[model samples]
Target: MNADELYPKRVRSQKSDARRNLSFASRRRNPNLRMCQLLHLQHLDASESKINGSSICNIRSVTSLNLCGCTNITDMRLIGICTLPQLTRLSISWCVNIKGHIIGCGMSNLTYLELRGCDGLRDVNLNDISALLHLEHLDLGNCNNITGASICNISTLTSLNLTGSGCITDKGLSGGLSTLRQLQKKKQVTGSCLHSMPSLRRLNVSRCWRVHDENLRQMSTLTKLRYLDLSGCAVTGSTLGSISTLTHLDLSRCWDVTDVGISALSTLPELQHLTLCNCQKILGATLCRLPALRVLNVSGCSQITDVMLRAICALPQLEHVDLSDCATIMT
Candidate 1:
């Protein structure tokens, strides 16, 4: 928000991330910051700048803070952040320096936290995050040393993103893919799974290649999932039909996904937007069962011919279809 707009009690987020980082040069408070103390600022975006806790501790009413790309800030300043009782959303994406517990005590009101590129996310802090009883959304893409085990207890989460978390495996999310394996790999078990957070609506495990169909099946109690992105994972959509609430699904580049697995998706009556880009194995015959589908992306399906296109044509509700690079389709 601009200087003139900061006086309101119920402040909205700034229109852009371009806001100047409220810098307190050499711990000397900026005279320009005098205006910030007087206003009841609700949202602050000081990303990629020199803003520190010493300068920001006074902004008590701030409910949302975007510190994404702020390379200078460290976990030490989180004590200053914890002072803001109303702070809920904090984005520290790409802040590589924070190598310790980012969350301090007394910041329980937080509902959304994004640490997309921080490497300091260890089991020590990931376990602490479960204390946030009100937390609903968390993004830990490209982080390290964290598993579903560390976060399995946080039953309050509604949206979670583990994209590119290669350390995560089938045994982490599921007790074990098979009963035989369950005993062999029982030590890796996190007790509950996709079931641990039953309230989850949107989950992104894209590129978590260790995740598999057996990991997603039988043990996956994700009945509330509406948006699930398993793109580039090892999943074959074996038990995906059980997630009947799904509407938007992305299985792009999932080379193992086949027409047999795609057949199970036919049972998802609510599915509308489905993406299977580069998944060449499917011939597109089973997609006819998804009559409610509105958007379909089968780009790079080298095996798809005119016959497959004709099968997709039967989807009367299709609004946006992507069949690019299907060289086999003849006029």
Candidate 2:
């Protein structure tokens, strides 16, 4: 309920030994119990409850609210929910009817927000969200009427998901880099953590068909990224090599990936979990080179034969692997 679906795919791909996240855990580790005083720990779960619009505003003192899969949710009810003074984390995923730009209505305290699968949210103003100074984690996956250029203007965000958003094209990404850096420079001297936070630590642009290497390779300002998903994108891996700090990467169904590009991945010291499923080009020749990889998925890679499977199984640090649908690999 606490914006848990913000990293939906990441949670599903995890293994028993998935690397621990110390990013937000440090605050929870503090010995002084009072130091970690959270805003509002109370939560309301009206998700799919068929709750009416008038009754929606009656809820109070709630900080985290879950309205996932709520088919009857209307714009007015959503507006009422957003007006909750203490609301900080909200998930309106799959809410079919939410429209209008009124999400910014009295919602000045939001830090985590998820609007996944809400295609009705289109033509919304960037200022309505940029006004949310504390917003850090945001998911706009599968939403309509979004432009990559507009997203780059929100300088305070740390994690962003634009999965299946056709608005993300190569031209837009190339232009957004300049817009991002310009915003970065304008807020460089700000002392507030809300304004001074660096570029995205996690990003998901899966199923964005128009994202190619011609635009992706030029964006060097995104070097701070740790988790990246380019699943079903048409990148050839030129930019993947430059993101050396990346620990988790998903390149599933990236058809253009080849030995040259995959070989470049061996140099990534911190990378652990990688998924290259359905990639027709992967032959497993260069995959075993990633000796430090812990979890690997090469499922549906038709070119991976039994010899390649042996090579993959020999990886020193590999703990888990998926060979499903790889008929060529008889072993």
Candidate 3:
């Protein structure tokens, strides 16, 4: 017999044992049990396992729950998790089949939530989140279907992550975040994030192919943005110049951007991490001007010459550099 036969997998967690049957043999001696402060329920190994509806209901006291990579489970199971009032943090990444339609759940106490890789999630039901007055941190990355309309309800949120969610135009940023400005002062709300949800210190909007420089201008109101990622976007140099306060920026795969556009990007004195991968137009001269840059990724920029390599070396603060796949860089 293997360990599987010796110790059968229990449906209810060990924590439920406290609320379960209290028999004479099991209860005669007091078993010293420790309470779990946080619970993460992921399906990394059991991606195809179907979550039993009844078993899911048994987990009530869990404050933090993760259901990432659980491909087999539907939105119904996720809805079940959100109904719990005590939940503070939740992650449901990579559950591709689940639709983004959230409605009628009491997510009032949630402070941190992650909804990455739920590609099918389309409509975010704002009515469900209006009561979540205490919510702070949220991540909606990689949900390409959700438009800016869904964000209209959660303007009270502070730290938001919108790394790869789709179809967020200038109107969306202006509509969603601007409404938030009414709730608090500039210091409380404005940071790197666009519109009014400004307390964001770090933001990632990479691969959002539709966003433009005008959208970045809306973000200039956010002076507190320390980390930003604009990789694979269509923003031009004019748009990049609008966000001069960024400390970390990733412009990899931004095909439309040229060396002229990046000229203003190097002006940020606090910039530490800069990535220009696949931005085919950038030369070595623009790379050398970044004085505070520590980590720079220039892979796939074919226009860089040997002279630019020396320029890159000239930066006093430069530390890490990626010259991979650039055929013309000097040896």
Clashes of each: 0, 0, 9
RMSD (Å) of each candidate, 1 decimal:
7.2, 10.8, 9.2
Candidate 3 vs. true structure, TM-score: 0.68
Query: How much is the lDDT of residue 119 in candidate 1?
Result: 80
Best by lDDT: 1
- Descending-TM-score candidate ranking: 1, 2, 3
Residue by residue across 181-203, what tens digits does model 2's lDDT show?
A: 11111101111111222355665
Clashing pairs in 3: 100-121, 100-122, 177-196, 189-198, 189-199, 190-198, 191-198, 192-225, 237-261
- Give the RMSD in angstroms, all C-alphas superposed, for model 2: 10.8
Clashes of 3: 9
Instruction: Please provide, for model 1 over 169-210, each residue's C-alpha lDDT reduced to its tens digit, 9 standing for 90 to 100.
Output: 444554321111101111222223544445556666666545
Better of 2 and 3 by lDDT: 2
User: Which TM-score value belongs to model 2?
Assistant: 0.69
Q: Which residue pairs show backbone clashes in model 1?
A: none
Q: Which whole-number lDDT from 0 to 100 does residue 75 have in model 2? A: 75
Query: Model 1 segments beyond 4 Å from truth?
Result: 1-38, 153-155, 166-192
For model 1, what is the C-alpha lDDT against the true structure? 0.68
**lDDT for each of the candidates?**
0.68, 0.63, 0.60
